[model samples]
Target: MSSRASAPTPPPSSPDTGALPMVQPAPSGSSPQGLALGLSAYVIWGLVLPLYVTALAPAGAVEIVVVRIGFSLLFCLVLLAVLRRLGELREALRTPSRWGATALASGLIAVNWLLYALSVVSGNVLQASLGYFMNPLVNVLLGVLLLGERLRRAQWAAVTLAAVAVLGMTVALGAVPWLSLGLAFSFGLYGLVKKRLPTPGHPVTGMTAETLVLTPVFVVGTVLLHGAGQLTTLTEGAGHFWLMAASGVLTAGPLILFSAAARHLSLTTLGLMQYVAPLGQFLVAVLVLGEHMAPARWAGFALIWASLALFTLDQARQARLRRRARRALTGSQAHA
Candidate 1:
């Protein structure tokens, strides 16, 4: 449902927002609650997010992002209060090391949100969907280069094919799809930074900290725009004003559900579930938005999907082996 940015194949400690920390297998008696949570979260992210952004007609991307950050902070604070996690937030603020990390993450996530909102408003939802589809693989590459993680041969092939797909699309479009690249790399990097941070505490608290760092920018931008009469929410109507104000809940709600779902689902199931968002996005772009999908773009999507299939299969295989090994160890210990 979310990336907050996806973790590498093992399903990061969390889906993207918080560190779920304990990823179980799909077969541990799947819960209806998990399924519902995962589906709801993804649907909101995939279907609702685009529609929401598109509905904010004539609002510039910067304006929307600014509003989103401000509201998201408010939403997180409220949730933290309800959850009694304000202490966690205070702890994060007290730590200087976390400030820099959260700041970088805030910047990356801001860029991701800005580009995503822009893509939807501009009817470039296809590019946005493709960018997210490309993100996990991008994380793979980041892991290899930045985290010194080794990838299996299949993983390498997947990464290479992803590059080829992007190259093919660029050749076909006759220009680099900067929007897609911008979304992919920025979110990928955000996940990378979040992975390095201390995860023993609440994830929403971490997100709240990042948004706190970003609040000043939004505050200033809001003031400047309002002073210049460029902020249009007041003129828009009560409904529009409420929608803008609801940005925080929209941002954090799915994430909270996702973290709950993580408690019930396996890494494999959650991994598969994550696809719902982009697929929803892709469908919305084609069916509702009526965005053009040329033959080359289709071909590019085909390549990316094929690469993802290979990558997913490889991860599944590795997970199976790991499970078997643990089972064997347990059996031997029993004999002893």
Candidate 2:
């Protein structure tokens, strides 16, 4: 064997269409079994939050985002080079409309990244996690409205519950959970846009392009600001600086895994797995990080979980029904 550690096996790619007559299998091959096996990236994400708040030089959210974007770009570029995926990147960028869409998603990711960093540093990883928990519903809604996909009744109930939870959070905060909601909505919408791209670059390479696009501007801005003695937070210490670079690696690693998962799993299963990251964060905040959630916050969490539970059950029922229907159709075809 080669000395180097093997790169993690990516989640399998989106599978072919459902063959059964009654089942409408997802365009993406999302398997619940594979989910448990392939989804460690979220756990990595959960651990990284505490590391995030504790490190990162001056530790402001904006600068964290800047460093994350810079380093993630570097990490992603390396992966792309190793895999030779630049042809895919060029193909994605070749179309004008797709190029514009990529640009839009990139901008939204920047906003989402900054908000998430702020939420973590400001002692609200729980809130950020909930926001992500809310994302699948938003994605489902997008499918209904934008993609014209038909959703089942149980899925509808899940969406309704999620909306209620958002309202509950707003009432508790005496303000909209803007940070959480914004992150959820923007990232969710980013996925929707990518879904439409005829050839969306692999998330890893796509994200790298975003950073590369912004890097020149970011460098120029940094130089100008530092020249005026305005950028003092760049290097507080060796420890903080290295931690800052690690954020970039952290950012892209999960996306690479998720893209792999996206290929092998259905959107519904992916949505449920998405909860793993935030739920871990919630536990860590309460049990490890020692953050507290008041009653209302706890209630908000309950509502979100209830919504997700309904969503998962609904998906399971659908899968079962489809399997039965497939068997029936096979028998009928044999008789003929």
lDDT of 2 by residue, 142-247 (tens): 7677765666667778888888888987887687888778877777666655556542545655666666656764677567656765453564666667776776
Regions more than 4 Å wrong, model 2: 1-37, 148-150, 199-201, 224-234, 258-271
TM-score of each: 0.92, 0.81
Ten residues in sequence with the least summed lDDT for candidate 2: 13-22
Give the per-residue lDDT digits (tens) of candidate 1, residues 1-336. 232232257443222232222334455445899999888888888898888888887777889988888888888888889999898887776766777777887888888888898898888999988988888788888877887777777888899999999999999989898888898888878877766764324568877888889989899989988988878776788988988887788888888777788788877788778778888899999999999999999999999999989988988887788789999999999999
Q: What TM-score does candidate 1 reach?
A: 0.92
Clashes of 2: 9
Displacement of residue 110 (Cα, Å) in model 1 is 0.7
